[model samples]
Target: MKVLVTGAAGSIGRVVTVGLAELGHVVVGLDRVPQPDGEDSAWHTVDATDADAVAAVFEEESPDAVVHLAGHPGEASLPDSLTSHVVTTGALLDAMVEHDVRRLVYASSNHAVGRTPRGGPPEAGPVGADARLRPDTFYGVAKVAAEALMSLYADRYGIDAVACRIGSFLERPETVRHLATWLSPDDCVRMVAAALTAPAPGFAVLYGISHNTRAWWDLAPGRALGYEPRDDAEDFAGIIEARPEDEAEAAHVGGPYATAQFERPALDRTS
Candidate 1:
């Protein structure tokens, strides 16, 4: 299948593109920014916010599936949180509809439901997908909007949309938080592959995390996606936890992205 990956220069995007290529799928990379200093791909640098640009890229590439990953990643203090949501993703939606793309895997975040009840380990079983979306930051708000757009497109335009609320993607599972919610890079690819080919995924928003000991969210259809994660956070427990608290404080911040301000004013985050 020909796949288009937006934000092809990003951490996951870069890996996903190469992974797709290795899987024998043709990849057309899209990004608003140019290739990073040394990174590379079949890149087409187009601002995700531009409708015509996105449309042109989609029309030219005509990929069978589009994994929308292009957007400003969350930061502690974002200058504008809504730009990526309203501009980048919104434009991509229009392009998808215009080009008659079939499957679209939107990169939603765990924070989409972060405001829900999360007390113990994440592996205790998920708090539930139906948990009301109470976004704690402007970035979360954008993800919520992106999910809504996927729904609208799926229902109204016959687009097969899946909003994957992804968990942590860490090199090692060191702290208590990652054990329950780690999303290894390989698992990430598998999840996307599964979502793309799943029998009858009818407008779904599935959690994107691996099966781990301390999980709070249940990974249901994730299995159906044929995703069996090989990497577990527990493997690194001995090493990561080997250090004491003060030494691991930064590492223990739940997820690397939990601190994301999503380019919004720091004063607006839900503390």
Candidate 2:
């Protein structure tokens, strides 16, 4: 399968692009910046926000699927968040519609349910993928909105869309909270590959995390889609630094994103 990955120069994108290629899928990369040195995937210098540029890439590459990892990766004002997440998604979906691309594997975030109180193991079962949205910040809200768009497109157009609400994607578990939330680089690739090849998953949401013993989110949804994550964050638990704020961060599924530090005015009035 020929796959197009946006944000190809990013941390996760870089991993996914190379990983997919290693899995024998023809990989094509798209990003606003120039492709990094030593990388061999077919590269396109185009911002995802520009519908025309995205469309042009779709027409030229004619990919079988897309792994959308574009847009701002951090908190922003509401409008900026919408543009970075929603608008960019809209452009890709529109391009997919035009180009007849059938599959999309989105890089959604755990913050889409950031405000949900942590409950799993002793207290209750892990949070299911069908849990209601409790977005922690503008960034989370944008993710929810983008997901709604994917659902709409899936239903109306018969496009197979899979939204993976990724947890803390890191090289290794660095903190106590990460013990339950870390998504290993290898697992991230596995998740995307499964989402890409799952047979006719019309519209699905799956938590993106490794097979961690301390996981707070259910992996059943991902497993249903053939995403069998292998890494377990608990393997590195002994090396993780436990900080005083770990309890507070673990209070909600979104960690510190649900806290006051991310609370900002809806609009940037000064700008």
Candidate 3:
């Protein structure tokens, strides 16, 4: 299958693009910036938020699937983050729909349901696809909105949209929280591959994390989509030091993002 990967120059995008190519899929890379030399794939420089630009690329590439990963990663000014996350995603979806691209693997975040209490009783279990939205930040709220948009497109336009509630995607586990939330690069690739190939995945949400024994998010939904993660953050347990977290941090799934505040004057709050 020919796949188009937005944010193809990003850390995860770079890896996924290569991974897809290795699997014999033709990858069309799209990003605001060009990838470094040695990336043997078709690439395009386009701003994802620009509807015309995205549509033009979709019309030209005519990809069979899209891995939508382009957006502002959180911790920035509120407006920039929201616009990038929501607008870019909206444009991408519209373009995909217009071009009859059937499969979409969205890079949603665990933060979309970040306010949920963690470390509960074993019966309580980890957060699943059925969990309600409790976004911890503006960035997370944008992801929640994007998920809804995907749902709409899938139900009304017959797009097979898979919202991947990705956990902390890091090169390695850096802290205790990471042990349970880390999404290894290989597992991330595996998850996307499964989502792309899964049969009749009309509209679904799947957790994107590794097979960590300490994982607090359930992987059953991902498995149902044909993803079987092989890596575990515990492999770095002996090498990485676990840091102590406060009660507030320990209470919620999003940790610091659940409590972050971008300081602003009262008069500038609306701005």
Candidate 4:
């Protein structure tokens, strides 16, 4: 399959682009910045927010599917957050419709339900994918809005949109909270691949995490979509430094994002 990956230069994007290619898919990269040296995929330096540019790329590449990972990766002003996540997603969905592309594997985040209290084995039942939206920050709100767009497009256009609510993506578990939330690089690839190839998944939401022993989210949804996560954060539990903040971080599904540090005025006064 020919796949287009947005934000191809990002930490996760870099991993996904290469991994998909190694799995025998034709990978095409799109990002605002120039493609990095030594990478071989067909790269396009176009911001995802630019609908015209994004459309042109779709016209040129004619990819079979898209893995959207482009957006502000952290807390930001409300307008910026919406443009970065929702607007970018809207543009891609439009282009996909125009170009007859039927599949979209979105890189949604756990922050979409950030305010939900943590629950899982040894504590309580895991949070299911159908949990209500309780976004922690403006960034999280943007994710939720984007997800709604995906759902709308899927229902109206016969598109297969799979939203993966990713956890803490890192090389290894570095903190106590990571033990329950880490999404290993290899597992990230696995999750994306599963979402991409799952037969006729009309509109689905899956927690993007490894098979962590202390996971606080349900893995059944992902497993149903053929996403068999292999890595476990428990392997590096011995190296994790337990900190006072771990308790608060583990208190919610989105960790620190649900804390006061992310609180901000809904409207940007400076603008």
**Model 1 off-target regions past 4 Å?**
36-41, 75-79, 120-125, 242-271
Candidate 2 CA-lDDT value: 0.94
Error of 3 at 269 (Å): 5.0
Tens digits of per-residue lDDT, candidate 1, 102-213, equal: 7888888877776554444645445566767866566777788788877887889888888888877665565667777788888888888888787657688777887666
The residue ranges of model 4 lying beyond 4 angstroms of the native Cα positions read: 119-124
Provide the TM-score for each candidate, comma-separated. 0.84, 0.98, 0.94, 0.97
lDDT of 4 by residue, 111-132 (tens): 9999998654555578889888
Model 2 weakest 10-residue run by lDDT: 118-127
- Candidate 1 accuracy as TM-score: 0.84
Model 3 — which ten-residue stretch has the worst lDDT? 262-271
Looking at model 1, which ten-residue stretch has the lowest summed lDDT?
A: 246-255
Better of 2 and 3 by lDDT: 2
lDDT of 2 by residue, 138-193 (tens): 99999999999999999999999999999999999998999989999999999999
In the order shown, the candidates' Cα RMSDs to the true structure are 4.3, 1.2, 2.1, 1.4
> For each candidate, what is the lDDT?
0.73, 0.94, 0.87, 0.94
Clashes per candidate, residues 3 or more apart or on different chains = 16, 0, 0, 0
Candidate 4 lDDT score at position 209: 92
Report the Cα lDDT for candidate 1: 0.73
Any runs in candidate 3 off by more than 4 Å, and if so which? 246-248, 260-271
